[model samples]
Target: MLIVTPVTPVTPTKTNFEFEIMNQNIVKALAGIMEKPGTTKRDTLAISRRVTRYICQQRRHLLTERHALRRKARKLRQYLPFTALAVADLEQQASDHNAELLEAYRRVLAAYGRSIIHDEEGIAAALGFDQLAALLNINPVHHEQAKREGGETLQGLVFVARMEDSASGFADEWGAGGPLFEACMAGLADFIRTCPDHLLPDPFAPGEVFGPKLPPQLRMV
Candidate 1:
């Protein structure tokens, strides 16, 4: 009779570490979802939600910065007349910088809006509008009309008049009408979060506490 010795099972420490690494990479990718589009098969609704939330956050941040600059200028205005000239120059510079940042943000939104059109079916499924209509007892004809009206596809049926409009007129609107646009985006994001049958997890969920840092370009400067 031969005695057989039992071997100990391998520890799960390495497996756990690998899982952590994978999670980190996913968080990082989601954070910069707009950086390289068409490279991944991301869910349209998920991307839309994330982008909307990001736009809201960035708009608020930029507004706060602008307010702070204005406050500084106002404070300086109380001093000498020479300081008034300097304050005017400072305000002009701040306005120019804000314009540049707004332009960059508009480009991001335009790209996102086009992507939404590119994946309309995916977005429709993610939004579960059909289910919503059934729950609300809405007419099918009205629902279809709401989504597309007069040869134009509405941005998520309410945000913008048309998908293509996002790149041109919508972009201009966002820059000029920042608060209203931010509110629309916020509402859309909220709808995405509460939409039924949504499979994508929230990018800002608490489980992402140890997520990788955002790239410098993605940061609100």
Candidate 2:
């Protein structure tokens, strides 16, 4: 259906505010999936839908948190040394800010408590990520939770949806990935390889080849 890269957790842009919040909301809701105790499912679509629906308010939350975080981080800088400092002072402020940040995200995460996994197996088959049914571990998931913790929400939703859709279509086209997949892969490779590394603009204009249709400055014998 589509191909795209996932957006970051936090974005520094004006237009993508809502999407940022939705992504944060996702991290909040599927935190369990990221936490030690994780989700149990074989279907990617169901999982994605479940995660997506919970953050109806993601857009708002992202901006609010972003502004709040920037303000707090600024405050932390005043307390920084970029040099050695007393153990107690460093420990106190670091611990304090970390807790504040953690609690803030946790509140948002809790917002997505039961919204994951709606249609179950249907979505998994759709995305073709159904085979990745097992949770390899929690830390990595939590790390993913952290990575997308502050990205543009709308972008992420769009991104994942596109990948699933693209993969699904490709699967159908090549019958679960074959010549069609290779063709697409080859196209991308060619694009990367043949694309000009850099092209400097010409300094001089070309001699006038023609005024409109006839050649310019031509002399008949």
Candidate 3:
């Protein structure tokens, strides 16, 4: 009679390893902009700060969830032989979350870039941001004719009114209250109007070749 030896199976690693790497890279990129003055568009510093704050907040929450998932996956692995399958399921969830977070980060960046261009052009002052408080009450319908024209006429007025309402408290943080400031305002308005409301970019939250592609040219600015 011959003695038989037992076979050892290979253990699988965490399925979300790639997503974790991607998440780290995004963090590093955003942080890099903060550390180096000229890494990103100069006019975007204020908006960048706001975007970073939101991202950091999200990353903190995601980190907690990732840690908790890791612990649970480990515990399950020790107790079950089929742990690989379970871990994969958990990682799938993590992947979905990572995808959403990454998309939001990308959207914010694109929107901000467009805003920088508008600020340089002084579009916000032309919209009469200083008099926004007085114009907020006007029914948006009066501007409907202009809005239909899609010539940026109504969009400008609407942007000023919306910013006055949404980003009411961030005057100083928006920039030196100049074109850069108004650019920040218009950029945020453009993102809000174009992106699905559900994405909820910047909570505070351009033009042709200078803007992102979308209907209502200026609306997507």
Q: Which numbered prediction scores highest in lDDT against the true structure?
A: 1
Off by over 4 Å in 1: 1-28, 31-42, 78-80, 96-101, 117-122, 125-156, 160-221
* True-vs-predicted CA distance for residue 116, candidate 2, Å: 4.0
RMSD of 1: 23.6
Q: What is the C-alpha lDDT of each candidate?
A: 0.47, 0.35, 0.46
* Angstrom error at residue 175, model 2: 34
Kindly list the per-residue Cα lDDT of model 1 for residues 11-110, writing each as its tens digit: 3378866975675466457757644665333343444445544665665667676676677668777774747666776677557545775666655555
Residue 190's lDDT in candidate 3: 66
Candidate 1 lands at a TM-score of: 0.40
Which pairs of residues clash in candidate 1, taking residues 3 or more apart in a chain or in different chains? none
Higher-lDDT candidate of 1 and 2: 1
Clash totals in order: 0, 21, 1
lDDT score at residue 2, model 1, on the 0-100 scale? 27
lDDT of 3 by residue, 25-144 (tens): 775676566566554333234434445445545555666666665665566666455566776666565555556765565555445546443545454355443333233333344344
